[model samples]
Target: MNLSFSKLFFVLAFVFGLFAVMVIAKSVLIPLSMALLVSFILFPVVQKLEAWGVNRLLAAFLSLLMMFLILTGFLTLFSTQIMNFSDQIAGFTGKIMDTLSEVIVYINGNINFIEDLNREELIEEGISWLQASSGTLLQSTFSTTATLFTGIFTTIIFTFLILIYRDGLTKAFVSFGEVENQDRIFRMLQKIQRVGKQYLSGMFILILILGFANSIGLLLIGIDNPFLFGFLAALLSIVPFVGTTIGAVIPVLYAFMSSDSLWVPVAVVIWFWAIQVIESNFLNPKIVGSSLNVNALVAILSLLVGAAVWGVAGMILFLPFASILKVICEEFDQLKPIAMLISNDISGDEKKAAKNSMWIEKVKGWFK
Candidate 1:
């Protein structure tokens, strides 16, 4: 009984400690998380520039400039479309309300078996809740926006400093007093660098493919702001599971609102569905491989927990961070069990099977 009680107490304490860490991470760790993600994304470009005979500092600066320009250009190009989409929300809400009313009327007229549905009461309650929550929600949104802006600024500064002094940083990590410790640190850094570069590069390629596919589909379906929708889709695709679905809803809803025919929205949905299926089954395996090997369930859970902890930034950073943890765990024999639990190694044959499956799919795709 004493041992059982102690174990229970320990579990409860651990849970509370995790919650406290998450809360503290929102303010204290978010910027550093963002910085790490940015650094990972930029690392490959800097390395490529270095390979082409540029100095590390110059290469890093150029890579940073390029990233900033790309971001600025995307925002500039899509600003009007985003504004228009936001402006149409009131109309969309009204239309959805009307649709709900029509559905309720249809149900009441057709099914006399269930008369007391209380649709009106439900609608009223929903509206009342929305009204009550809107002010607080808006205030919370603005606060979050301010925090995000500050975090981004800090991340940018941190990323620039890290990149500028990357060589010195590496040297410092590798110059520990003990040779074994120095070697271990250097190896760890190398592993992290390789994993980070591969993850970022694979993600970039996947996003680019998704963006182009989405744009073409939207265009073919006669959507108004195809480019903007594609951009949004690409951005959201960084997040796992729900991201693609959320991305689809925007374009489909836009189609519903703008187009007179219901078929447009239906087509948009089908298009997104097909694209997502292809991405999941084919593209992801080809691009990302089983190197980072995080399990889908863990990835989704990490995304949710990260979002809860640090909002969108956390959601964006969570997967790679989790992947890094898995890598670290895998590198140490004592921690390999935990790594296996988190990784996509359910059958122990995952790596070999994934490679074979990827090649098969690639061959099929090429022939088709």
Candidate 2:
């Protein structure tokens, strides 16, 4: 009875802790999480430099410098395009309204399966809603901007410290164990490093390939500011499910508005679809397969939960953290069940066994 009560209390405490985390995510957790993620991503690069006979501090500095330069270059190149895009949003909004109106008219005229749809009122309501929430939206935007800067500052500091003392950190973990357990801990650390590095590197490669492909495709289709649109798509590709659609929408909408050609957007869609198909089936399997091993459902759910707790930054950091958690769980025998649930490693035999078990259970229940 005491043991059971203790277990119940532990579970309740865990739930309460999770609730507290969700409530204070932005102020307390987000910056630290972002920092850890950035550090993990950059750790491999620093190690490579160290292998090349560079001092750890200098290697980390160089790696961080390269990252900063790349970020600055991207920002410099894209700033003007972003400003122009922002300026054109009002025009885009008008065009969208016009397009919606045309669609409603077409639908009303053709699909008369007892058409009682109040399309005009719906559109008006949407416009009204946008206007009504404009102030709150602006306030939210500024607040987010402030939070972003703070997170960036904290992340930079954390990443630098982590990189500088990565070896020490590993040794510290090892020190917590007996000599035999020290080896195990060291091996786990190495595995974590390998997995984290591979995941980040694979993602970077995928992003670049997709970005370049998008830019070239957009240029071929005569889309203005193809590079900008492509870069936007590439960045959004960091987000699952919605990234490709969001990326495709801008170019397609621009094509519609600029050339007034429906075929252009349709062609662009086809091109994006082809690219996505290739990436999913071929490139992703070759590059990222079996490394993170997170199931699609779990990834999506984690992303949603992260977003709800912290927003876009949460979505970006959630997957890698989840992958790390899975790795940690897998490393310990007691936590293997949790690891299995997190992993995408359901063998055919296991699947068949599970199916048969389900069927047997159902048969027994029916008989009873």
Candidate 3:
């Protein structure tokens, strides 16, 4: 019993130490994590280019350029929508404030929460605060934007370096294992790369499908700028359980503030509720979840742990890391149970179908 307790304490200490290192090195790791995923997505292209006798450096550079152009195009579309949103933001804010005043009045009448409430004074004070903080707000925005670009730049460089030195890295990893296990280690590395590639490709398809589905539903409901809201919501849905709620809430809030009929927001809620059902039951399990093969329990645990450790970036990186972890655990007899626990409990035909994914392969075909 004492031996068991000692072993448990050691395991706990090891886990905590691992997490501490991750938190401390996040600035470097986040970019590297992003690059590792990106490299997997780009690796096939690199291989094809090499097959065509293209120089390795040139191939890596070209792949980065292609990635940059794709990102820039999406950014251009999003920026145009941002401009449109900015134009109407003042009216939207006013409507939201008006709705808040009505709610306050209702609560004051029913609950007698406060003796007197002056919303106008509150608004005036809020505006005064904003006016005073405008310079600080502007500086913060500029800094955030700069950091975003810098992070992107760093990710690109790391990706290029990873691609360039992939051979060396593979050997380094394989060398860590015994001679009898080196071949298995090499294959494990390949599986890790495939997991990253497949997860990302599944995500791209999932987002596109969700964006169009959301936009169509909103258009049917006669919501303004349905595409913008739909796509923005779809983008947020990348974060998992919490993301779905946030994505839906944004549009629901807009409907509440802007539409005259209370029924409009109700209908918006109904649509998103239906979307949540379909996505959780059908789309996600078949698409993204299949790629990760992570059970909901493990996925949620990782999401919470990642959020606690590395914020938004952790949330994004850790799911794939979990998948990679499963791959690693499967190699050890004692650890295979950990892999089993992390994995979805599908078997036979279901497991085979998950392994035989067409999603990422279909996405990859577009590059050719």
Candidate 4:
């Protein structure tokens, strides 16, 4: 009992210690991690340019420039939509408040078990509170926007430098391992980069498909700015489990606030739920593939722990790294079990089938 407890205590201590370090260094680490993952996606572009006889410096510059342009395009689209719709959104305030007041009044009238509730008084209190805090809210929004832009700039700079020195970085990492194990370490790095590249590329394609699908559905439902809202929801889907619901909620709330009929919001909800079903079962597996192969429990745990350690950036970054961690763990006997634990748990028959599979080893050999 004592021995088992001792081992467990040390393991927990190590985990907590890592978390403490992550939290303390998050401001630096978040941008660096973002840059690293992005570089993985961009690495192939850089390589292709060089192979085609482009200057090394020019190749890197062009790759970064392309990335910058793409990102700028997305931001411009979102900002334009938000700017144009801001007034319309404000116009919904009265309608939403009135609807809420009606609901509360109906509840108070019907639910005799509860005391009489003054919906008007409650609405007045809420409006007054908002008025009082408007300045603070504006200040918070400004600060958050500034922080976001600053982080983006830092990540871009880091990504450029990483692309310029990727080879050196790979060598440095390999050198940290024993000479006999150096090749294995290099292979692991390649695997990580491959997984990162494939995952990001797949996510981009999936988002495009989803955005188009959502827009078509929303347009059929007679929603205005369907494309804008569709792409917004699609972008949110990048963050995995929590993001999907949030993506759905914004449009659904807009439907409720803007339409008199409950069915509009209900239709929005049903559409998103159907998208989720199709996305999970068909689109994601086909596009994203099972490269990450993280189990639900581990994926959710990673998101929670990452969010605690590094906020939204952590939530976005950690899942792919968890996949990378599984790769690293697979290189060692002691850690292979952990890799399995992180992976999607399979039934015995499935496991047997995987063990019997020959192509996996063949693919790994090609990399070697």
Candidate 5:
């Protein structure tokens, strides 16, 4: 009893300590964690380049350059579109106001009490609140942007160094374990690296597929800036369930504002719905394959926990983190039970088979 109590206490304390560190050290941890995953993903490119007689440092640099160029191109495209749209901000504002008025009228019609609500007074209160919060919001926005850039820069540098010295890092890690355990550690690391590479690549491919599908659907439905809305939604879809809904709102809002026909927004909903179905049923399972192996419930919980700890970064990082943790748990004999508990691979079929086998053995014993 005492031993079990002690173990429970220790485990709870350890979990709390880990969460505290994650919350407190997010600035450093976030960049470092990103760098680790990025390095893992890029390692194969570096390896291939090195096999072609390129110097390790040069290969790593080339890999980084390729990534930077692709990123720059995407950012340039998004920014240019945003700047062009900004030129018509006044028009958009008017449309927004009109939409809000329509919504207010619709609601007031449905509710007698709401008919007494003064729209002008509500608008005035909202404007006053915005004015009060504007300075703080602006400051926060600036700080967040600066931190984001800093984190990206730091991640790039760390990823480069990691790629260059990956062999040394592996050797150093292996040296910490006993000689017999060193091989197991190396195997564990390899599994982790494979999972990281496959997972990241799959995510990238999934995003592109979603973006293409969404853009095509929107274009067919006559939504303007289809690519912009589609790609933005694809990016948000990285956050799991809430992200797709959030992304869908942009095109839906545009449809509501720009179209005289009521069917436009309804079409927008159908388009997103179809894409979501395809993505959930087909693209994810086929492209991502068995790399993540995190079930939906656990994945959602991890996203929630990660968001609570590190906001958006947590949501992005936690899935891969869970994968690595599962690998570690499986590698250690004492932790096998934990691995089973967390693994999505322990599916219904496997459990059913195990139960059937147990029943067969019990029947056989009775016959004997």
Candidate 6:
């Protein structure tokens, strides 16, 4: 019993230490994680090129080139849409301020507790605040944009290298384990690679399907930039639960701003909500079902922890990490219980018995 306690303590301490390292080294780690996932996705392409009599380095380069072209196309489209959105924002600023002034005046008129407030003075003060903050906002935006580009550049480099040296890496990993364990390790690695590849490919198909579905809905509702808004929302849905809401809010808010009728924005909201339902019910289950297989509660907690540790990149990276962990846990006899706890497969009586035993042990320990 004492041995078990010590082992549990060691496990918990290791997990905490690992999280601390991830948080501290996120600048480097996040890019490497991104690259690792990308390498999995591109591995097949590299293999196919090599099978066609291409040299190893050339095959890796070709795969990277293909990825670069796809990214370039996506960025070109997004940048064009963003420039248009910025132009609209620039044109609408005066109207937005006017609307804000009216709102402040209306609120002041309705509330007797805030009788000290002057509408014109409030408007003047608000504008002054905006002007003062604009410089700081711009500076931060530039800084963030630079960091984003740097991360992308590093990820691209790392991905190419990983593709070029994947076999060597696999051999290195296998060499560290026992000879009898080597086969198991190789099998685990293959499963991990397969999961990574399938998860990404499934996500891409889901995005395409959801994007099309959303575009149709928005078009039917007569929303401007249907394709752009739809695809953007679909891409954001990659982040899980919160992503759909954030994605939906963007175009809904845009609809409110650009349209004169209240009904247009209302329709926009209803449309996105409906699409979200379809995505949650039909699209995700069909495309990405059981691939990660993480419990909903555990997944949400991981996402929050990831966001706290590495910001947006963490949110994206952690789900796959959870999947990798699940794979690892399943491969080891002693960690089977952990795999069950983190996994979505909780309906079994065996899992229930294990969980109950765990809780009862903790309860018994409290008195000691």
Per residue, candidate 1 scores C-alpha lDDT tens digits across 59-112 of 888998999999899789889988887887766765666568668867887886
lDDT of 6 by residue, 1-368 (tens): 33466757787999899989998898899999999999999999999999999999999999899988997898787787677877888877666777887887788788855777776787788789989999999999999999999999999899988998899999999898999999999999999999899889989999999889888988999887788899999999889788899989988988888889999989989988888898898878778856878888878887998889998888888888888888998887666666766887656588787776785565445324
RMSD of 3: 7.9
**CA lDDT of every candidate:** 0.79, 0.78, 0.86, 0.85, 0.84, 0.86
Q: Which stretches of candidate 5 lie over 4 Å from their true place?
A: 1-3, 105-134, 347-368
Q: Please report the TM-score between candidate 1 and the true structure.
A: 0.76
- State, as a TM-score between 0 and 1, how close model 3 is to the true structure: 0.89
Q: Give one clash count per candidate, in the order shown.
A: 0, 0, 0, 0, 0, 0
Best by TM-score: 6
Tens-place lDDT per residue, model 5, 1-368, is 12356666787999999999999999899999999999988998999999999999999999999999998898887787677556755477556655676677668778865646776676666567767998999999999999899999999998999999899999998898999899999999999999999989988988998898898989999987778888989989888777889999988988887788999999999989988888888887777747887777778888999899999999888988887888888887556555555677644697766855664554344323
Cα lDDT tens digits for candidate 2, 241-327: 667678778787787786776899898888888888887788776776567788887888878977877677677767777788888
Q: Tens digits of per-residue lDDT for model 3 on 125-209?
A: 6567768998999999999899888888899999999999999999999999999999999999999999999999999999999
Q: Per-residue error at 180 for model 1, in Å? A: 1.8
Off by over 4 Å in 1: 1-19, 44-61, 83-97, 100-141, 165-178, 289-291, 346-368
Cand. 6 Cα-lDDT: 0.86
Which residue pairs does candidate 3 place in steric collision? none
Specify the poorest-scoring 10-residue window by lDDT in model 1.
Answer: 359-368
Reference-based TM-score, model 6:
0.91
Error of 6 at 79 (Å): 4.4
TM-scores for all predictions: 0.76, 0.78, 0.89, 0.88, 0.88, 0.91
lDDT of 4 by residue, 1-368 (tens): 12356656787999989988888988888999999989999999999999999987888899999988997898787786677679788887777677777787787788854576788886897678778999999999999999999999899889989998988999999999999999999999999999999889999998999998888888899787788889889999888788888989988988877777899989999999999999989998778748688888888898998888888888888889899999998887656667767878477786566753543444343323
* Whole-model lDDT, model 1: 0.79
User: What lDDT score is found at residue 159 in candidate 2?
Assistant: 80
Kindly report which residue stretches of model 4 are placed more than 4 angstroms away from their true locations once superposed: 1-10, 77-80, 107-123, 345-368
